[model samples]
Target chain A: MRLGMFFREALRSIRANAAISVAATVTALIAVFILGAFIPSFMYVRSAVSAQTSKVDVDVYISDTASVKQVNALRDKIGTLKTDGQVAEFTYVSKDDALRLMRERLRDPSVLDELPSNPLPAKFNIQPTDPANANAIVAAVKDDAALDPTEGIVYPQTTADRLLTAAKFVQWAGFALIGILLVAAVLLIGNTIRLSIFARRREVEVMRLVGATNWFIRWPFMIEGVICGLVGAVVAVAMLWGIKVGVVDAWASGADTALTKTGSAGGAIAFPLLTVVLVGAGALLGAVGSGITLRRFLRI
Target chain B: MARIDDDIHDAGSTPRAFTLVEVPLETVPADLAVVTPPASEKRRRGDVFRPGPGPMVQFQGVIKRYDGDVRGLDGVSVSIAAGEFVFLVGQSGSGKSTFIRLCIRELRATSGHVIIGGRDLGELKRSKVPYLRRAIGCVFQDFRLLPDRTASENVAYALQVTGHSRQEVNRRVPEILALVGLDGKGDRLPRELSGGEQQRVSIARALVNQPRLLIADEPTGNLDPDTSQGIMDLLTRINRTGTTVLVATHDRDTVDRMQQRVIALHKGRIVRDAEGGYNEDPGDTGEIA
Candidate 1:
């Protein structure tokens, strides 16, 4: 029953102070909208970069004359590296399997048939825990006794290095942008709430004189703030959903651009969950903003 | 001062009533005769000061010094028992407002003590000020009504903010409004009402809580003579019901005509305390009596 009174008071204040409420809501919307758009885009970029880095690996070849026991020993060493948290995993490809993979890649099987016998070397494709750690894994097993002398180990160092660098830059830039946007949103919304409370400070003083507790006076203003925040977030989420459907989806499918191709290959974004988080964040910001701004006025 | 003591004869044997009863000012047990005790007789720091019986308001050598060393109240000692209608007469800077503010605990005394209803305000916790204010109804000159709320809503607000049930609020709001002579006008907003009607609404709001003390700071400052008279009469009627009413005003004609106990202040010090008009001695200098 008391909650009903608080809601009624809050609704009345909002209606009476419609301009301030709108200002606060718009401020929240701008902040939440920017955040909603940035989150999925950031996730999509990170996933695409991760997909690229996953292709990095060190290939260790076995000599044609190496004994089965020698190959087993190499596999055991790779297993030890995995257990030590250096190697992610390793796949052993026999010469026959390598030859069959090449035939599948060639335009004509006749080209491979002309070889008379398989010349492809059997190798263990060892994935590293981090793409940046490829060089360390390569150096660790490059001179192993069981490996072929001519093709002992091979890894695409330049590609892995470039991908890792770009990923690091993107991650840092994303964090900085998000931090700036959040601070801006909080300040703008808090200022709006402060102005609204300031305008009604006389009413608050009268309430205090008439025996209203600090919380009694605060609950209505807080409810008004939460309403403003929720409205802003709902509108921002709708706009984000529109952008996802009308802009993001169409741009990704309209061309074979690097961003669109990778985004599509990485799978769909979790927009429903992201919207919930954005909405929750907006409401929390509103509540905290009003709660803090009211402290100075409640000193009576 | 001796004349005030002679005028206020002992009527302490009368029983106190919790609700409003229309008794005349003469029957109010004129307890203003209890003069401030000397320094040696005053309660010490560790002692609790509940005046002889129970004065609704007491200020013992209360000194309120603001920043930059200006004194809002300087060594003002006064005691007002329950159910006394007293006029705090003073010019703009005479500290009448400061006294009222101190009574409500809006400002603490820089030194000495302000006791209300046997409670020493200096020792009252900050969190407990609301409850202290709740027992002391306040009416201002501006009729501080929320612009958006109707007369009834404005009055109900007092009860509502204190967590009273809606039914109790519904029952008490109209009763207080009718008592303050705002009966059928409860639906009107402050803008729709006259200056007099607005003050009536303010009074209703202040009295709805049924506080033991009612402090009106220039309640009639904004009203014309006739309207001010009506407001003062309503206050007097409220006081007759056993609530202590302290009106801080410089309204000469009403103060003279009412002939209530007048505590006149000048330069933050009381220069006159008697049962008389606004200026019993107009030529008296602004010095502590």
Candidate 2:
């Protein structure tokens, strides 16, 4: 059949079954809407979580008796950890640099200037690639001979552990919610199409008796499904854009919300790409729902 | 009880074995046995079906069993030649519908063969069922027409679905609609037409392809007697054009008036097959035992 013929038939069917068609479209819209809205919010939360975790770092302090060669070896060990993805980066603060940093921090510069021969010890500030990896990084270097015996390494272990747990929860819960919603959407859309097809099953039977091939009969229905999907997706994307502009943008612009404190919520979500993905997903879901539901009816 | 005992004796083990009345070619009236020209020899507008040489439909001990072991058709065998008009007469549960369904390969026989136009329907691939149906026009009691389409579009749909070009569909649609006595009613939807007119539109759609066989399961079941007569007359006229017509009906008066070949089924078995009125003598045909 001609492409135009399929479209004409599909349009005619959609008009004839307007109520069910609308139901199917609305089903797709609701599904796509929820999924689209959740995606950006989840991304924002994940970004904020990572930002908080990025602060947990390992601090290695060296003893004054340690030789330059031992310090150099420790620096090389940190470089190896960086390559292994355990450490994000390491910066060395020599005794003189430490004394200068301390002098800058003290409001009374004369107090720091009274110290004789810079009594501060050198240390290496180590940032782990992941907050949960801070404990591992500290464990890897705490036994090294170049470090001080007493306060050799210091990391906010309790804070990193709690942040890691919270981050894991956020990631898993977000995925579970999206997954459950997706399955529910598929079933709802499929049921609506099933009812629609059931209403017109006699039409299909007559077509089969009149010598129309299965694909010939399937084309118009499939096209109708695809049209519903595309329309629903476009509507969902538009709604999501409205919410982004009206709700999210308004909230982010306000004074010092927790989201704004993280400074990663606004301007970070890709609205254009999200629109494309949501539309594509809507179309795919619509097509699959109707196509599979039509199988049992076509056997006649 | 006697029939059951006889069936067991004849079949040795199966209690439903039936004796089919085979209508010998010589027994058929000379005029009704007229040989139709091969489809390729006389190609005309909308005549796409090419029926191979031999009987148009043959059922060899075909048995159909529904769920719960209820026999729909049991050990039934019959053959219908091309270009003949036959009436299938039976009660509601006498397997008339099952026979028609088997002819279209809509139901498979349990252990027998249903061959159509020299092709075994049992072996016809599932994908090819539509092609098989294309060669056989079918009508029903309800006049199955698309409610949204006009009569002309409904007839055109049969050709359009098979990828016929616009020029072919346009030409054939009007001709077939006119042939079915719906010349000026092409633009009317099914709901706008009377019961008889709706059935005519359905017949138009069915015969638009000019199939080799036409099976009507109670084509006049919903119509008044006068309208039913008109529809039967139309079917007779179509049969005159060399399309084998098989109609299953409960209209005894029409069967008596037509005086066509009648096959009577009782309890899923053919009890009589003879060219006469509805109450023709069963012994005049094949042996029942």
Candidate 3:
């Protein structure tokens, strides 16, 4: 028999079972949607992790009574921090500058002028090369007698701890959600294509009896499964992009200060590539699911 | 229409074995098995395409069974000449269907070689089964025509299954349909036709490829005497076309009346072989056609 004729017959069989095809498509759509929902959640979590990580720094307050030579020695250490692999940034503020900043923050314009001989101390602001070690770097600075009670050290320890916890939570949660969606997506398309194969088992058996090749029988279903998955992914991406742009952005721009306080709450969803990955992945996942179902039940 | 033989008449038939009378018609399953050709008369139509001989169908000491232990055909063998017509008759479950199925490679012989047209059916690859079947036209008693397809479609399907292009299939299907007396019924589906017509459609399917060997399994077992005569006439006409015919049936009327080579089988062994008088016209000897 003609290869073209057999494929045409297969296409006709698939068409005749319109209800099954639609059911499979709907199943694919839902499977892909569930998978797509997890994509942006992962991106948002990643973004949160990065934003929180960027806030970590080490602060070193110098004593006003320190010798000029000692202060200059510490300045040299701060300057070589990058090459030494100890710090990311170093900012130094003199006693006069510190008093002026405190005066401004204290919101008493006359406080700096009233201070006797600039009571505030000079300080070196240090940021670690890695956010993870910011607290350790601060502790090290404070352990030094001259940098301890005399000058003091400051670090955003509480905020860093909280942000690290949030980041870890997001990472684990996103990973766990992705794993579940993968299986669910496979099973979703698997059952759908299984029914598709079941619907055409008669034709399949006929073709088998007639000596048609296994690939000749299976390629169409594989193709159909992939196409169905792509459609599902496309729908999901559109929905995700719409939620990201039309709704989230509009809300962010419209006096949503409270929403913005969650560290650019809506900005984390800009991931265009991630959406493509999710959609493209859905198609691949569909192919794999089809492979399983066809292999298992199509008995090819 | 092309004129066929003169002896295919109702009164010219012979005794039929295991008719509907024997098999209770009170109520059978929906899938009524219309197995026509009985598998008696072991004629090993000699080696086909021998480097020095004409084509033949040959079987050498063939044994067959289902469970590999229960004997189907027990060490039986025979040779049949090319272009000869023969009939096989035996009791129910006497390995008639098994014999033909073995020749077609639908079932393999346990201990023998079945060779046809220079190709060994036993040794042919699984993929080559269709190609092998192309040279052999098989007609079932139940008329295994696709019920959903029209008469021409049913005939065309046989060719289509053998890789005939649309042009060749369209041409040969009509010719064969006409040959089977289904000329104008090409558009009629199997169910739309009478039982005899359905069997004729099957015959048309069998004849579509212009096969060298026509294996009919009770081609008319389902029809009444009159209708059965029509079917026998069709097969005889097919046999006259220089094609070897192997018919397995218990309808002694069609076989004895026709006076073709009769190979009688009793419990899987040949009991009778009437030959040489094959071409003697029934009219000259007062015998059935």
Docking band of candidate 2 = medium
Q: Mind listing the fnat for each candidate?
A: 0.74, 0.79, 0.10
Q: For residues B128-226, could you state the per-residue lDDT of candidate 3 as single tens digits?
A: 454456557788877766555688987776656545568767766766676667768999978899999898888877766556778988887888989
TM-score for each model:
0.81, 0.81, 0.65
Candidate 2 C-alpha lDDT tens digits along A245-272: 9987887787668767784745256898
Docking class of 1: medium
User: What's the residue-level lDDT of B222 in candidate 1?
Assistant: 93
Q: Residue A190 lDDT in model 3?
A: 82
Ranking by DockQ: 1, 2, 3
lDDT score of model 3? 0.66
**Largest lDDT belongs to which candidate?**
1
Name the candidate that leads on DockQ: 1
**lDDT of model 3 at position A60:** 83
Task: Please give the distance, in angstroms, between residue B221's alpha carbon in candidate 1 and its true position after superposition.
Answer: 1.1
**Model 2: C-alpha RMSD to truth?**
9.4
Error of 1 at B263 (Å): 1.2
